[model samples]
Target chain A: MIHTEQLTKVYPGTDFAAVDCLDLEVGTGEIFGLLGPNGAGKTTTAGMLTTRVIPTSGRALVGGVDVAAQPALAKQVSGIVSQQNTLDRQLNVWENLYFHGRLFGMGATTSRRIADELLEQFQLEKWAQASVYALSGGMAQRLMVARAIFHRPAVLFLDEPTAGLDPQSRLALWEVLGQLNRDGQTIMLTTHYMEEADRLCHRVAIMDHGKILALDTPAALKRGIGADTIVTVRAAADPEQLAAVLARDVAGVERARVADGAVQLDVSGGQRLVQQIVLAAERAGADILDLSITEPTLETVFITLTGRELRD
Target chain B: MAASDVTGDVTTRAVPARIELQLRPVLTASYSALGALLLRDLVVLWKDKWVFVLRTVIQPFLLCFVFLYVFPKIGQGVGGGGGRRGESSFATVLVPGVVGISIMFQGVQSIALNMAQEFGFTREIEDRVQAPCPIWLVAMAKVLSGAAQGALSAVLVLPIAAVVHAAGVHAHLDLRWWIILTLVPLACIAMAGLGLVLGTSFEPRNIGLMFGFIILPITFLGGTYYGWTTLSPVRIGGFHWLQVLVLINPLMYVNEGMRAAFTSSPHMHLYVIYPVMAAFATTFLAIGLRNFRRRVLA
Candidate 1:
């Protein structure tokens, strides 16, 4: 539904380009996540793809129309939910949705009916007549989502869809997004939340400093790291002794390090190695205060690839 | 799994369908979009109905009552020829000028100032720009809304200016039917165009600078206190340069046209009035539309 080739945007006053040589493709009926930290060019990329920002160079096509050459046509097929609230604070919920529908050339009666259905579906029926200013943060975010979908565009771009919401609100919004994808809307969203990307996105691209570091399914990304488990052993004595023991005994131990009085190890067969390490440590008369076993997570994969935390 | 498969299906179906739809005339669709945008602005404004009404009527009311009625009675004096002569009364001259200035201020304050805020922190205009229409249409919607507010200000100012006075301060509203019908709407459009340009040119942070640098000068030099022709004597040599300088001001024509409609005052020739006002509307609109597009894209 969306494609970009070497898409770059350089602001006038800035020395560096905000979006640098971005090559991306979002398939039809798939929810694609663009994961990045702040100033990582996520919003800039979304703006260029949605035709809100003109590209300095390169090309973008949305729903089969060149965004630079045919912006109005591109706009017709795509909806954008910006990071900031764009809802008219003065207008009621129903009016906001109805107005958006009409802007996309729907008839008044048709738009009104669709707005009513969307308000109910988004669980905003009671607040339909209420002013936007009166709505809670979550309600306003849901209204923004409903407003974006009012035109029934083929593609939707949500920038930080749940940035400031409480945990419960974020979960509710995720459910709404899942429902939208199920009903056949191609969704592209930008977020910094690894858990959100892992749980909701069918595919995610990890980005930093205006470049994509990696792109794959959540499960595929974890598997691609090739580490089955992460084992940590906290020692009452010296951690180096426990680390040396694992380094010698476990054949598939990829790496061993000691930090914060804990012996950390990455191994392929973690459960079997953990048993052998416990027996070996007991024979050496070294006390193990605690032990932890974890499956490889998206955070670990991100840290391995970028050498920096995703939340940073 | 291959990229070719995705591009092939989209090219075979989606491109052709979109092209077929594009071949049809876009005028009706464009108008529908414009109507929707205007309705959206109106609905948003409707929630602040009391504030909207107050904003529309308050300034004109206070100006008319204070300057026309109260000042003249309290001997603060507006400095017209001291007579009950039909054309020389202070109230007679001030009424139409007040109405004209009210329209201009309404356009600037409601449309331009409001647009500055929208383009500022909230960026509420992003929603409007996402509509399936050309970017110029979004700017046009703002101008139209401003013109509507200007018309309301005109209606609200006239009656208050006409009746709030002591004896012998007559406001003989000639109400030239054709001039009233044609010129008022034109005057509203001209003011709105001016507002659009100023709104787009100034950032929200510099709005106070706009009032200080642009609006105050326009209000004073726009022939609000006196007719444009009357400024000929306040000129160098026989050139009437002061009169000519104010000719570039759009509000001058609006006020002069209003005087021709509302009272028995001399005004600039209609030949000069119509074309210059049209020129102002066209120039302001073109520049405003360009600036609005630039700001939105930026």
Candidate 2:
């Protein structure tokens, strides 16, 4: 488990704190996500918790040991897959894992067995003897994860683990993470990928500008958006006119607005609202090009809370 | 999975014994991790065997070949033309100096240059420091492995430097087994400690300046071509200023130690060489470890 009390970090030569008064707790066996865009202080928060970056103020505890006070012990209990590829270029895949295991004080036989299991699990057995320089981005990332957990750490901190992978590799890594979580690892990761956070995290903290705007289960956060469904309609008419028509005619429509050349409506009865919008557009002699109804998503919740898109 | 499944009560013994039990594992882990770190560097060096061979041998070989062989053959041998005895004595002095310089360069190249890359834009030091040991111990690991490489370079360069000479220009090595056994290692470690200081003090981009400003001067004035005792003649008034000034160079101590090890030449006394080399080693390591910890934290 990981806990922090107002953990903070202000890097030198910068006025703004990278992590500000962050009070966070991650329960054992929970897959927690720190969701944010670039420069959102997610990596900095992860750094402090992992004891890589000493906090400017406040405190963090990992596996019941104060990270600042007993950094080596904290490091022993937690594994970190850094945002950047920090794999040893001089080492082959097997050497990287074996050395990590050795560093954690595993016996040679235990280290070898774990390295073999991880290489197989991550589908990197073929490259076990291959130099890290020879690996592709996805393979290297997988190796980083494999090396991190080679010690059977109590807490795992993954800083943007899927940043540069292709879709297939990203999904593969998601399954790997999910399997780890299911096996009872306390996993925490920082990510800007909305879908990754939604699909993978048990609980997510939506972060921006060194502060958490919202934290909850993805489903709860989405449902907390205050609307039953979202109705989006793209038409030949001006989107503002479509919005006006939806607002005027739709009975259960809570809000209507134009965005990205489309009229979007927050409504209670989505099916009925979609039908009403089509009829109104036809009556106004506007050709409807597209229309769809959607449930509120984590993204919509994020936008509702932050007044900006997740990537903004 | 339930939280309790992963968070079962970690067993503890009685108070004093429990503390010992915890400390014991940490100490053993540090020991094993240090060995693994050293092994990793050695394995990489082994893998790049040809590169290692070229780097270890070529510079020393050329220095010996030109100074001991070509110069004598071309009738421009050092210490004036005092005939075969002069060239032979010069060879004796130059051989250990070649060995000394090799160790120094090995230390710097293996540790300082490598550290620059690790700490540069690559950020490779992050992975290294991730080892479950005190951060200072991690830096100590680098110094130890670098010392090993420096010692290896001393061994590798010695034979090539000893025999690659013109006719009648062979180094008259009066090898004291005790000195060779003791002094060479001490000198290697001292130079490697110097490497650690240079590695951590300078940024990667400034490494070129390190060689230009520090390494080159250390090599030239480090008593490589001349014995430290011989510098007594190059005086400012009645004072041996050149000899005193070169005393500040760590490699001077290493070269003096090497001369004591490999020859019967009138070198700086062992009484001075031993303690001074130890002092230099301790001083460099202390500063280097402090700088290392600071850089890693930063």
Q: Count the backbone clashes (under 3 Å) in each candidate.
A: 0, 0
lDDT of 1 by residue, B1-298 (tens): 6799998776554333212223212465578888987887677567677887787778767766676667656766464536455323556667788889988988898779888988998788888788777889889988998888788778877888666776666766778878888888888888999899999999899999999999999989988878777777886777888888987788898999898888877888887778888888889899999999999895
B141-172: candidate 2 lDDT, tens digit per residue:
88888888888888899899666888777788
Cα lDDT, all candidates = 0.82, 0.84
Model 1: share of real contacts kept: 0.49
Write the residue-wise lDDT of candidate 2 on A85-105 in tens digits: 888888888989987887777
Provide the TM-score for each candidate, comma-separated.
Answer: 0.86, 0.88
Residue B12 displacement (Å), model 1? 18
- In the predicted model 2, the residue pairs found to clash are none
Report the number of the highest-TM-score candidate.
2
The residue ranges of model 1 lying beyond 4 angstroms of the native Cα positions read: A231-266, A271-293, B1-28, B44-50, B86-88, B232-248
Model 2 CAPRI quality = acceptable
Q: Which candidate has the highest DockQ of all?
A: 1
